[model samples]
Target chain A: MSTEANRLPTATLPGGHLDCTGCTHRTDDWKTGPTATFLGLLLFIVYSTAAAFQGEHYMYENYLSPMYSPVVFTQLERTVTTPEGETLKVAIPGAAPVEHAWFGLKPDAWPEWLPFSPAFLILAFPGAFRFTCYYYRKAYYRSFWANPIGCAVGPFRRGLYRGETHLLLFQNLHRYALYFAIVFIGILYYDAYMGFFRHGEFGVGLGSIVLLLNATFLACYTFGCHSFRHLVGGRLNWFSKSPLAHALWKRASFLNERHMFFAWLSLFWVGFTDFFVRATSMGWIPDISTWG
Target chain B: MAERTFEIWRGDRSGGEFKEYTEEVDEGMVVLDMLHRIQARQANDLSIRWNCKAGKCGSCSMEINGMPRLACMTRMNQLPAEGKIKVQPMKTFPLIKDLVTDVSWNYRQNERIRPFKPPAPDSDGKYRFQQADADRVQEFRKCIECFLCQNTCHVLRDHRKQEHFVGPRFMIRVASLEMHPLDTDDRIPDLKNEFGSGWCNITRCCTEVCPESINITDNGIIPMKERVVDRYYDPVARILRAITGGGKKLPTA
Candidate 1:
């Protein structure tokens, strides 16, 4: 096949760098898609970083942020009152003391030699999970990388591209990261279980509701993962013979369709859950408790 | 008589605009039927391509209302009748004429993939495959080469990473050959280094636009990706490969 013969008869023009000189495929709505994605990711980064560093308010009487689950570093417990006027002490099991600085049961969750936010320790697991996620790869690639910015629009640069074969090889670690993400979901549900206990009695609070919603939304996003879909349903030749697998696959497919929606919703909602816990712990907001 | 308005693209690669045309359309008529009417009645020189008037032939792929789809497969009733139905060439490929694109780029890519290499024959001089194994490859065999998946893919459409990505169509093409039970060649190196399997990112946009409903991303691309990860990235697999002189080899039939 002759390359020249296969070429279209349209007038050719010189391609350029930076300016996208001589490109004719520009459209008016091109900026909207990349702009939205850019702002969304930027907002997430800023808010998540601020909340991660503000170490004082991650845990209140019963509620815990998904960001700081598994209770890796804690000093001790303290007594506090809910907005509903019930007094309860924060006595979470496996909750320990910090050796260094800031808030918690004891003063030193951080050592003199080590100065770091507790959120920093665990945020990377979920952070890496999202950063290496297939959906987020597309999100950041378009929004941050400006790789063409949008369809038919000129890209920022043109060059020899070896896609994900070299420096970006860590993207292949997504399936491995997914295992950690699944384990984190278990950790979060455990936090939700702890939310039901205030002074060893069963009760519901506004924080409890928020934690449950965060867990549910994040679970939806995690379960809807393309990797999860492949593991659960893919590789099988027969859905007919495997009825249980087929049923689970159908449910996964249903969630997969809404993965993008859940991704953004859970992203913002999880951040809000963190903020809610922080504000209430900081005494900026009041938590309404319920006897269930 | 109700007249359906269409803003059909009217030019070639150099420049183009959505030129408006109003035509009488009946219920159950498709966009391709309207295009055929426009060709016969209004613009005799207008260039468009179609075959099988049905959806099976992936030839008549173009953007209708900003989505890559088969012109024949899209029903006239499905689209909002209140506005101008926009018909344009696929943005990813270079435009040849009105509603026609030069999709030879996909053909060039298809040529790069290593074709199926069957295992050595037994005493009977024949290769045998289990029904289950055949069924696995059959899912991918349903691809009609429509290029809708290729056109809709953001890596190709938005990023123009043609140098790095082969789009979703060829991923499954390589997959169909790789997953064949009777095949005995390793294309994993090509998929890793040359074929751009690492670039796919698995958005499933290709699966969404597939008229054949092949799960191009989940079933085909992800499995191929895991294989690439296993061979190249897995630490345990790498150590085992070194000790065992590069893992398991397919048996001669």
Candidate 2:
């Protein structure tokens, strides 16, 4: 052992430095992963921003974009020519009267202080939930923040990391945000219910299916939450005593294993739901109904 | 007679190269068995560290086929028979010899965590804790100190942020101590500062490589993070605690 110790090199390699120049240990898939994440998030941001601003195209018949669901307020009025060629002017509560027939819920005018889209008002809840999601925290931290960019990869920020300690202390609100997300799931499901009713009679349309899928995907993402698993049965000593919570936790754990998949799936499908409503509402696509 | 080829690292700290050896391996034999055979039949100076061959001691941690795992637990049948399996010392730590990395850094880290100390005994002159409360920390105690989580942790492995970040093994250590029901020492400040619980990004890589299947990230790190947040970040909680002198109290058992 003494001889072996003597044979060992005396020089030790220095670590924990702030420099990341030309590090050799970065993963092979490093560039591709961040590039995809950057592009994907960027696409969602640009599309969602534009769709939020283009408020006229967010609703078709009873179908609504999950983004602008439970319309708190609207500043929209339009002139519509029905299939029978009768023109009518309809105005939502917040906007000036114009020659159009408006559909769906019309609430009191949005306070003049908040100027953007109605979608902007409600999206923050889900966005905060995703921003602080355990899986999404890794995704954005690696891809967007470039903090040690990938698993064993060279990172942009090299030195001491605070890691949601101080500046991102609000991230601790994730469990609280789960409450909002759960409530939104119910709201969106309500919209899905509204989607199936055109003129108070039961009807199924392509837009209804889109809204249904948006609710399903969002439910998967929300139910698969790590905090939900903890809230259900994480600290329990015996699973046998509380079988219902244990079973729910087992199901949540099963879903938590695929949390990443559901996260991406919900993100994409929510975006698609917005696009579908926008396109059909603007006459870019026909609202093909089963009965009609 | 199935002959499996092994590409083993064979040198010291300065440099090394993969030296190939073809060994006749048996069914139900693990990679450690082949290494023992090579040490006995071919090279006597082949150095490797192991104690309990049943995967409990955690002294046998090495990278097999570029994955950090215990050699004794890895069955030969699980490996692809066609390619040469490489056994290298864990890249996270300094190497001393062939297949033996100097893991003394881990022991030093283990020392940083404050051990459990039960408060002064009750009126009966004995410490008491409910089985339910003890069971809360029992899951984290399953760690065998294999340091696989330490070796696999990205903050330590890739960034080499050892000075700032305590790896996953010691996170479990800190979690075990902090969750003890009868223990009444607060380690949250140290966890935030010296132990570097904040540096963990909750990637679950450590939990994935854990041989004990301990939920190191979800159960240990995240909960500790919540405690840190409750103490340091939540202004209302902090102010209320300042007024009430209550912070992260275990229910009286």
Candidate 3:
């Protein structure tokens, strides 16, 4: 820690001054920015609203809970060679049914004591959103409502905006919250595992299978998350020197680089999984079987 | 020729107005061309910052239609004829004047990024890395520092933490160079605690505003943020990172 401060830039450039070599006069301060914050807010509202209503997020085609859609294989009887002399072929006797691991939200499982678990999940959507965000608090105050164009408006331009530190600092909870997120995945796997063997006696069913897949996709998305990787060991010295640490860092970087894509995809899949489970469990849609 | 109007902002720190300028439009005309014509015929002293109208240099970034963009890259034809086009400076920095903000803060934050400290090479002092390892991070280097992404970023725009959070675009710069396999820098924690790397909410405003089309959120910011989380919070990785000396650790299920 002591060495870090020594090596760090002094935060001041000695003998450095704003010479303004080519320019002339300057006088305006931060307080003069007009209320121009509505521009981004309006656009963001429009986009988020659109994203909400259009909720067809990433969903496994086979996990819709109504039919067992099998993987389509088209290589039953043919092969072709590329100009580069690469031969590729794939053939399956029939559409292979997707196997399940865990995830079952049985009607019987809904004990009265935990009656709100389903509804709670819905509310959790925005809750998860605020907790995991890396930029919203700043954007909300600056561009969402006040003004998108940055011009300070308070007298002396000093008070137009000042960030809140405590709430944001508390946001560090994302590290611990990741534990719950992982546990939820485990719960989902249990549901799927039950669904595979249950022959329809009020046991695990299609809902479990769909939920399991949702969790799997979400895991791919979450484990690859950028924030999660940072808490492990991003800034230490000899502490992170092991070969295992090196391997994990490499893998985390691989996943973290695609954080946005996975984030959005997983978010949508969670919603999709929930809707499928709801429709079937509520009897809004029949739990038909595709396999005899 | 259709006539068009521009609400060109005029004046300096003390005071200014949305001075309107009207110009004749013929065929292919760009925003810079309109400004040139205005400079020739109308307000000669209209102060605007611009350079390399070719779009490679990020010199002319401003809010076009309320979004941060390069004025030189926007075409007069793309805007709706019925509505007005509003142009302003990027949101997060101090305003120097119309469409120009003091971007010096970005460079200041860059100076704070933890200096590179790669593991010592073999006794021979040789390092090896394949092209595949360098390509993704290389994509982030196309940034011209136009500050459009910074302008578009909501964190710096709304949150008054310019002194703390370095915003996503700068994070991308830090992540790209530091993540370079041969480069020996460990910027993960400085990115998290000091630079406020966690402040970004993945809104992707930077990705959208980037003229270079770099995936600011996907490729640069998040990956670095993830590494920061691994080093600081994950128990297993924390133990591993302690032994490794600032390399990096992974996460578990």
lDDT at position A241, candidate 2: 60
Question: Per-residue CA lDDT of candidate 3, range A1-292, in tens?
Answer: 0011112122211111011111101122222322232443354345444433322221222333211211111112224478899987643222212233113222444454542222233334344643454544334443443433232221122244333334544554555666666655565565455455444434444655566676676676666644555544333222223445545656866776665456556555655554564455445676664442
Best by lDDT: 2
Judge candidate 2 against the unseen true structure and give its global Cα lDDT, from 0 to 1: 0.74
lDDT of 2 at A133: 94
Candidate 2 displacement at residue A178 in angstroms: 3.7
Candidate 1, B1-253: lDDT as tens digits: 6688776777786665566677998888899998888888877877888999888888999878766789999888878758777677887788788888899999999999878888689889987655645665798999999999998776786567888788889999988887676666788888878888877756556886899999887678877887777677777657866876763431112
DockQ of each: 0.19, 0.20, 0.04
What is the lDDT for A236 in model 1? 41
Q: Report the lDDT tens digits of candidate 1 across residue range A39-67.
A: 98899899989876655567777787777
Worst 10 residues of 1 chain B by lDDT: B244-253
- Write candidate 3's Cα lDDT for B208-246 as tens digits: 678888878766776666566566646666676577663
> How many angstroms is residue A145 displaced in model 2 relative to the true structure, after the best TM-score fit?
5.6
Worst 10 residues of 1 chain A by lDDT: A1-10
Alpha-carbon local distance difference test for all models: 0.73, 0.74, 0.54
Model 3 reaches an interface RMSD of: 16.9
lDDT of 2 by residue, A227-280 (tens): 787667653434556668768877887888788899999999999998888787
